[model samples]
Target: MVQFRKDNILDRLVIVNDSSSEVEGEGNRDDHNVGTCIYCPGNEHLTKPAVLVLVQKEGIVRRLSDTEDNRIDDWCVRVVPSSNPLVSISANGTYSNKPFYSEPAYGYHYLLVASREHCRPSYIPAEQWSNVLVALQDRVKWLYMQKGVSYVAVYMDYDASSGWHPNLNIVTFPYMPPLIEQEVESINRYINEAGLCPICNIVSMEDKSPRHLVSIENFTALCPWAPTYPYEFWIVPKRHGIQLLRMTQKEIDELATMLRVMLGGLYTALGDVRFSMIVHASSEKSRKQLHWHIEVHPRLVDKHGLEDGFGVHFLSVSPEYAASKLSVASRRELAKLVGIT
Candidate 1:
C-alpha cells in the first residue's frame, strides 16, 4: 500500500500489514484462529461461509458436486466473502451522485483461498492451482452479472516471507477504473496506429526476443521492455482471448502449469521475494480491442522519492538479464521433479 503524507510533499511510504486489526479473535491460538491463518481449513468458521468449494479425487480436481443442503468438510479450495470488505451489495443498488464526485461503494468482495494448508503459490500443486483458476473464472462471471457491478478486479499479493497468506481478492466496482480506462485508451491508440492488437503483437515479438523466458502451448511468459519494477514479467495467452472467463478448460489447465513453473523459478532464483500478480482484462467497453494478460511485480527494490515524485521507474537489472536468469532457474528447478524435465 502506497501512502502519502499531508505534512511533507516528498514523503511517501509503502505500508505492508499482513492482517487487519478488526479481525475477531485475531491473536488467540486456542480459538482456532491460530497465528494469522484464518484461511486454513479448521478456521472456516472464522471467515464467512464458503460459497464455493473444489475437492480432489483420485488425482482429478472438480467442484464439490454436492447438494446445497449438505455441506462438505473436505475441500482443496474455497471461496468466501471477505470479512473486512471495501464494498458490499446493496438491495436497491442506489448511489449518491453528489456535485463533488462521490458515490456509494456497493459491490461484492470475495476471497479465493487457493489451498487448505498455509503455503505459498510456489508450493501449491498444479492441479490445485487449476482448480483455483476454474473457481475464479466461475466467480468473475457471476460477479459481473450483479446489479451494480461494472468491473471486477482480480489480484493476489503473496509475501510469504512476511507471513502474508496466498489468496486472491475479487472486488467489484460500480464503474470502470481509471487505470483500466487508461489502458483501453492506449490499446485503441496502438490498434489505430499499428493495425493490430499490441499485446498480440507482443506475444509474437517477445517469443523471438532475448527477453523471452518460457513458452507453453497456449501461453508465453516474457519480461516486459519498460517494466515499472525490477524483474517484472508478463504471461500472455497465445490465443487472442479478451477475458479469463472465455478461456477453455484446457487453457486453464495449461495456465496453471505455467504459473507453477514460473513461480517456482522465481522462488529458486530469488529467495522468498514478495510479489503481486495482477490480471489485466478488457472492460465491457473495450472487450473486443483489448487482450487479457497477467503482470508480475517482484518487490525486490524500494520505491524512492524520484519514483513517487515522477511516474518514472529505474531498474538495476535489465530485462534481458533477468529473463536469462529466470530461464536457467526454471530449467534447474524443473529438473528436480520426477517427470517434469
Candidate 2:
C-alpha cells in the first residue's frame, strides 16, 4: 500500500485493509453483496450463481457458445454479480439513488468467475478468456435490450497477492461518464507548460480519438510518465474508449489475447511483481467519445514516503529503457525497474 502516513493526498488515500486477517472493516460487507469471490481454481460452487455462461467445446471451430441459456454441466467461463462491494461501481444497467447509488430497484454489479486454475488474466487459458469475451458482450446486450439501462463496463481486479480476492467488477451506471478528452487536454496542458507528462508525446503525435497502436508485436511492456511509484508501469488500451462492456465478442477476445501476452511479458522481464488491473468507461456509452482502457500497476516497493508526502513520484528508471527491457508489446517503464537499457 502507498504509505498513507507520509505523503499521500487526502483524496488519493484508498485504505485497503487486509481481507484475510481477523480484523474486520467498519462498513457492512453484505448489502451490495453479489456472492463469494470464487476466483481460485477449486471453489466453483461457492460463488454467486452464474447468470451467464460462455463455454468452449473441444471440437468448436471458433469457441463461442452460450451455456447460460441452458443449464450446462460443462462450462468454461461464468458471470455473477458481486455480493458485497468495497468501492461502489455500476455496470450493465443504470440505477438511481433514492439516497445516492440506488437505482430503479435494479442495478447490475456482476462478476466474471474465471476458469478453474488461479492464473492472472494474462495467463488464463486463451480459450477460457475467449469465453469471457463473448459472455461479457452478451451481458451488455442483455442489459441494453432491457429497460432503464444506460451504460456498461467490464472490470477485473486480480489479487492473489492481496489474498486471492479475484473477480471482475462489471458496472453500468444510470448515466455515462465524461470522455478522456478532458484527461488528454489536461495532460497536454501540463506537458505544454511544465514539460510534465513527458510520455504523453505518444498521444500528441497521433492525436486521434482512438489510436490503434499496439505495444508492438514483440514488446509487451511500457513505463508510466506520472507513475505514482518507484518502478510503476502502466498497461493502457491504445484505443479511446470509456465503457468497455459495450465491446463486441471479437473485441473482447482481442483484449484478452493482448492482455495474456502482456502478462507473460511482465513475467519475462520482472522477476515476480504484484500488480492490479482497473477498467474505466465513458458515461452513457458516450457515442461522442471512446473511454475504453485498462491500467496495470506492478507493486515494486512499499511506497512509504514519496507518494505519502508529495504528489510527486520518484521514478527510478526512464520509460524508454524500461520498455526495451520489459520486452512486451509496448515500450515504456518508469523508475526502479532498471536503467533504460
Candidate 3:
C-alpha cells in the first residue's frame, strides 16, 4: 500500500511506496529522446486519454476531451493523467497509529502539456501561455470541488538535459503540505498584528526598490529579500487575491505575459538552465489570510549539506544584483513579444 507517513517527531511527511523502488532506479532515459516523445502532437495514443483539450479554429477556441477511441489532434494545450502517478485515487483509506502514523496517499496527479510543438524555445508565446493558464484554472477549480481534496499543488520541472517536453504537474492532496501550512500560519499572524496583508505591503515597498524587475498590467515580478536559490524571483498579483480562480480574464492575460517575459529573460541570461516554477496559494479554508503567487527558482548551483539537512540556504548572487541583470533583458524581450515598449 502506498501511504503518507508522518515523521516520528517532526511535521514533515513522506510518501512511502514499497513497489516503486526498481522502476525509480531506471531514471529518465526516455525523456531525452524526441523520436519517442509521447507528449508531441499526433502521439495521443502514447498517453492516457486527455481530460481537457483546447483547440483553436478560425480564431475561436473550444474546450474538449478525449475518449478511448478518439483524441483531438490539433489541440493547443492538453491535460492528461500521469503515467507514473505519485498517488492514486483508488487508494484505500486505512490509518495506522502512534510512532508509525500513516494514511493512504489518496489523490490525483495530472500533466498539463503546455504546447503542441516539440523542441520549441524555452518560453512559449504569451497567447499559448494564456491557454495553458486557462486550462490550469479549469482543472484546479474542478479539483477543489471534489470530496476530500484539501490542496492542489501546481508546479513545473524543466531541465535542458532531460529532453522532456514542456509541461506542468497538477497534484491534489488530501491534507495541506507542511510548508503551505506554515505559510498560512505566518500570514495570519502578520495580519492580526499589523492589520494588513504582508504580500501587498511587500509589493508596495518593492515597487521602486533595486530588487524590482518588471510590472505588467496586474502583476509585478521581483526578487525576494531572501532567496533559497540563485536568481530566484516571484511574480505576485498587485491586488490581494488568494486564489487563481479569482483572477479576471485580463489578469490571466497579464500573468501569461509576465511568465513569457520572465522565462525568456532567464533563458537569454543563463541559456537553457534547469529550473522549477511553483504556484503557491491558500486552500479554501485559509484563503482570507494567504495570497497567491508564483515563484521561479533557477537551479544553477547544487544544494550542500547545510541546505539539505539544516535548512540553511547559501546564495551567491543577491536579489538586487539578480534583479538588475534580469530587468533589462526581460523588458527587451517583453517589447519584442507584445510591443510593450
Candidate 4:
C-alpha cells in the first residue's frame, strides 16, 4: 500500500492498497457494466486449481482462482494474480529475519474464491461467511509452508469501490530495495529513528504471534489506513509467519465466512456495484516473516468533483451523501436487478 512519493498526480498503476468512495469522473468511461454481476464458486471448472479450500456445512469444497480463471459464477469469488506481476515471493522473509536471506523476491500468489453463490456478501449466510475466513486462514498457512515464500496479503474491491464485486485478494512478496544499507542509514540519521519501516511496525504486531486475529470488518471501510479514497477497508490476518497459499481446512472455512459479512455489507449499501479482488504474497515460494490482511474498496460517489481535470475520477456525486444514501434495501434491489442471488 505504497503511494507515490512525489504525489504530483499518481496514475492508477501505483494502487497497492488504495480505495475510493466517490468516483472522480472521467471522459468516456461508458464501458462500466451496471447490468449484471457474475462470480466464481459454483463454477468450479471455470477457475484455477483451488489455492485455498472453503467447505460449507454441507461439505461443499471450493477454491479461489489464480488470476487465470476467465469465467466466474455467482457462488464463488475467484481471484487471479496479475498476469504481469511485479513483486516476487519466491524468496524467504528478508524483512523479518536478519539471518535468513535468499533471492530478492521468491514468493507465490493465490486467488481467493469467496463463495459458491453469485449473490453479494450480504446475501451469504453466516456459516458460509465464516467459511471464507477459514479458507483464508488455510491459505495463509499453506503460503508459510513454502520454502521461498515470505509474506501473504489478501485484497478485494468491494462494491462501487472497484465495481462492487465480492472477492478476496492474496499477495506474497520480498522487500529488497537496491540501496539496502544506505536506505537504513539515511532513515536512522535524518528521518526519525533507527531501522524503521512503518510497515515493519504493523508487521511486528503479529510478526511472532500465531493467534493473530485482526477484525477486517471495522476500519475506514474495510481497507488499509490512509486509503487513497475515503471508504477503503482491510482484513489482515495476525499470523506473522504464514502465507496465504496454504491454509487449514478449518481456517479456510472460517475465513470465507468473514468475507460474507464484509462483502454483504457493501452489497447492502451499494446497489450492485462492480469490483475486483486478488492476493499479494511473497514470490518464488520462500517462507519468510510477514502478516496477512484482506482489503475492501467500495466505488461510490455521491457528489461530482474536480479531481478529474483531464479524466481520472469523474465521479457523479459526493462521498458524504453517497455513503448515507447507500443501504440494504437499495443494495438488495440492485442485486436483483443484476441477477445476483
Point to the candidate with the largest TM-score: 3
- The sequence of per-residue lDDT tens digits that candidate 1 reaches over residues 1-341 is 11111123322211122234344421112223445567656655666677888887887766653344554568877787776665556423233222322334567878887877667678887777789899998888888777778889888877664443468888777666667777878988999898988888989988779888888778888899989888888889887763588888888888888888888989988868888899888755335456888999999999998898788898999999899898777656555542454
By lDDT, the better pick of 2 and 3 is 3
As for TM-score, the candidate ahead, 1 or 2, is: 1
Best by lDDT: 3
TM-score of candidate 1 against the unseen true structure: 0.84
lDDT of each: 0.73, 0.48, 0.84, 0.42
The TM-scores of all predictions, comma-separated, are: 0.84, 0.60, 0.94, 0.44
TM-score of 2: 0.60
Question: 181 in model 3: Cα distance from truth in Å?
Answer: 0.8
The better candidate by TM-score, 2 or 3, is 3
Candidate 4, residue 275: CA error in Å? 4.9
Candidate 1 residue-pair clash tally: 0
Q: Which stretches of model 3 miss by more than 4 angstroms?
A: 23-35, 285-288
TM-score of 3: 0.94
Q: Per-residue alpha-carbon lDDT of model 2 for 72-182, expressed as tens digits?
A: 436566665555432233222343332333223234667666655445555565455566667766777676655544656455544344333334666554444233445
Candidate 3 local Cα displacement, residue 319, angstroms: 1.0
Native-referenced Cα lDDT, model 3: 0.84
